[model samples]
Target: MCLLLNLFHLDLETLEQSNVDGPYEPMEADATNREHETEQGGTRFSDFIPLDFEEEEAVEEAIRRSLEEETVQVPQESRSIKTLTTEEITGIVKAHSEMVVTEGFRSIIVSRRNVWTSAIRQFRRPRFVESTDMLYVTFASDKNSTEDAEDLGGPRREFFRLLVKAIFQESGAFEESPNGFIPRLSVSHVQNRVYRTIGQMMSTIIVQGGECPALLSSVVLDYLLTGRMFDIRVSPEDVADLELRDSLKTIDQATTDDDLQRAIESCESWRYQIEGLPNPVTMDNKDAFVKNAIIFHVLLQRKSCYDQLAEGLECYELLPLLKENLPLRVLLEMPKVRSDLTADVVATLLKPSYSVLGSNKRPKEELMVVKFRDFLNSVQEREVEECLHGRTLTEAEKTFLRTLNPGHILAFVTGSSRVPAVGFQPSPKLSFVHNENKYLPVAHTCSNELEIFVNSKNLADNDEFEYNFLVALMNGANFSAV
Candidate 1:
């Protein structure tokens, strides 16, 4: 959970490094639209592909023709006529792997600087997108790497991290809160379709087998999912305006009419905000006034924003899934800090492939692998001391220490900081990196494979292996080519 927070904080630093910060300025909207138009005119994967309508019609026509004339010949020599049951038919089709339907891959290339804009433009392009299309991401910066299902995982994970920051922090679509972000009441944002686009991105991430946003207020998610707000409550601290919240807090704590009147007079907005309130408030109705204020500020004010966000979420058939799948729904709104990527869970889930194992006795290579496993378990046990009184470390040393953890290793190998609710597909692999000269660990994130240096000389050099592994993971953390 702390790692997840660090990941978000790291994303913010990336945004700052890219020289892009804050909400969209009024003047920048036109420039963004123009850039989007340019993207449409530039080279696009969508242009080569035909629209869904034409393909569907052609497929249907072909199927109709084939069914009308096709006939199957069955041998009738001394055979009893027995009807096949539904289960039997299903079993027959299940036997053939090719006959089963599988998710399609949707490949997208995006610039790191304009990830949100480029991704949305590609999503909106006229093309057939399967509801369950696995999103394959490629950052424009990575020019040498080939696009394959295995190689896309790292980029895809990083894409979600960046998109989370872009939509919530950079887009200025929602108000920041300690619990989660609440939708801000903004007519201009709604009119610009900001909320809807962000909603579509959120749903796209989920359907494409990526990380959930998990940054929305629980109340907001409940309303969006069920279309009803039940047992909804908001903290007084959730109120963004410091002065107004303090005034309400004072009013709520007031005992007598004099104290209530004084508290109410402190805030000028109370003159018109609450209706039918006695000028000199009494203890009897103070609670009711506070409740109304809370409702007005939290729910009623952002009603339109919520509606727009809901519309966006329904973009890629997410509504039904949210309604039907309890776990997914919970995960989508689960707080970022609630992630359960503990060391034990990650170590248990990793699938290792031994390079040397044939005799009854354990191979030295196997022992080194076990040593590496023990190191992963101890990652969280070791305190990450970034400060040493007044001494400062070199840049390389800092990078090495910062990334020496189980979470970073999991992310380095799997492309996600948190474990998926459904768990990892093709479980993360532990393989040995055999070289005469000891080398750092290499992670092929696309295939979820981690290669540790386990050569003959380095089998017992535990400290050397640890140093090389941490340095390698840190060096390649942002290198998405693998």
Candidate 2:
């Protein structure tokens, strides 16, 4: 055994040294020198010709010709199948290659065409998408599909998921994360999760193809082919909901006049970015989106845009809010929320006191009820330091306060668990002249609210009286000083 091991070691060393010293070297592929290498598992420029990569103009011409040609009927087991020829595959690939897509998409297809083609074979034959002007394909709809039951094919589905993600990565529209890449499908930075799943279906379908498929083609086809959102589904209740929503949309669109159009354009356009999950509103989620949009835009007085949006969503039920008269929906039974201050903002505002100048001797001022603006001004510094505890006012809070104008009732939440639902105040409701005893509770009302002057100058001047004079008349003033 020792002699054999020594002989093998000596032979290995001699082979290594002799190979280096002798006239033994592997030839490298030198495309520039016109000397091609017979290398395995590496692309040579020669391979592109077989893969059907061609000049854009030439490829486009071939595709145009093939598209004009009709397929011959081939019989197979009592069913006619259209088998794609080499020319057809070439035309399909070249046409798709030349189709408009995001920049990085083309290079990925060129590098992984064979793997993609194999993936495509898992589904039915590719179909030309006239809408997007590209080839498209989809999962083979199971003729043997079980109704409303899980298809126990776990590994197959997992493979499809991976294939779809790989395709989406080629588009360069996704953001890299620890888990994987997440698609950024909208400028809104948020989308419906179902729409995202639909997008994934589109991506998966895209890469599983004849030769090469455009990402946009699959995306457009996903919307065109299989959204059950507006469609009447198997579920009767869902069918009714979809039908109702569609009817509402149709009616709303028909009623949209030039004024309404302008209102839509004029409404300060804003999109709500829901936390954690971002998705485009699909037919399945249109109503919910509109409801949320209504609440956000209406309260913020971004009426025209959101109102029109809600209308477009076919939410006829929400149209009344567009008139900017959302009824007194803020329930009185709900608990009144308290102010964050040492004193209650609403209660303090309700107290009766006259605005007065300093007395002759004391030279001071006193009042129970101050103007909301004056109160805010008085407390701003302290509130900014202490009101938010350790944290400062967020952009959302600042924006809310800006839109929550002074005349609007600032309701306080009284129930510890109940959230405050504020009603819009188009015009003030004075309890009496100068609004001496009316205040709405507010949750976390700001200390630097804008001024909304309610008192008439003439009335205010008439109401003003010297405290000393009133005290003297009431037998409380030191009359001897006068």
Model 2, 453: alpha-carbon shift in Å? 27
| TM-score (C-alpha) between model 2 and the true structure | 0.15
User: Who wins the lDDT comparison?
Assistant: 1
Alpha-carbon runs more than 4 Å astray in model 2: 1-313, 319-366, 370-375, 381-482
For residues 1-482, write the lDDT of model 2, one tens digit per residue.
32443254345434434433232111222221212211211211100011122233443343334233322221122124345543444444334324422222110111122333334232222231112232221223235322231222211222333344343432222322221222322212111111222232343322222111122211111112222212211111111123333333432343334433333332222332322111343444434444443323212222222222222222112122212211111110011121222123222232222334454312111221243324333233333223334345566544433332111222221101111111011111112223333222112211211122233331242222211111222231111010
Q: How does model 2 fare in lDDT?
A: 0.25
lDDT of 2 at 395: 69
In candidate 2, position 365 carries an lDDT of 18
RMSD of each candidate relative to the true structure: 16.5, 33.6
Candidate 1: which stretches are off by over 4 Å? 1-102, 124-132, 142-152, 229-231, 255-259, 270-281, 325-328, 336-340, 355-362, 382-393, 399-405, 479-482
lDDT of 1 by residue, 42-96 (tens): 2111000000011133332422332232221111221243433222322232232
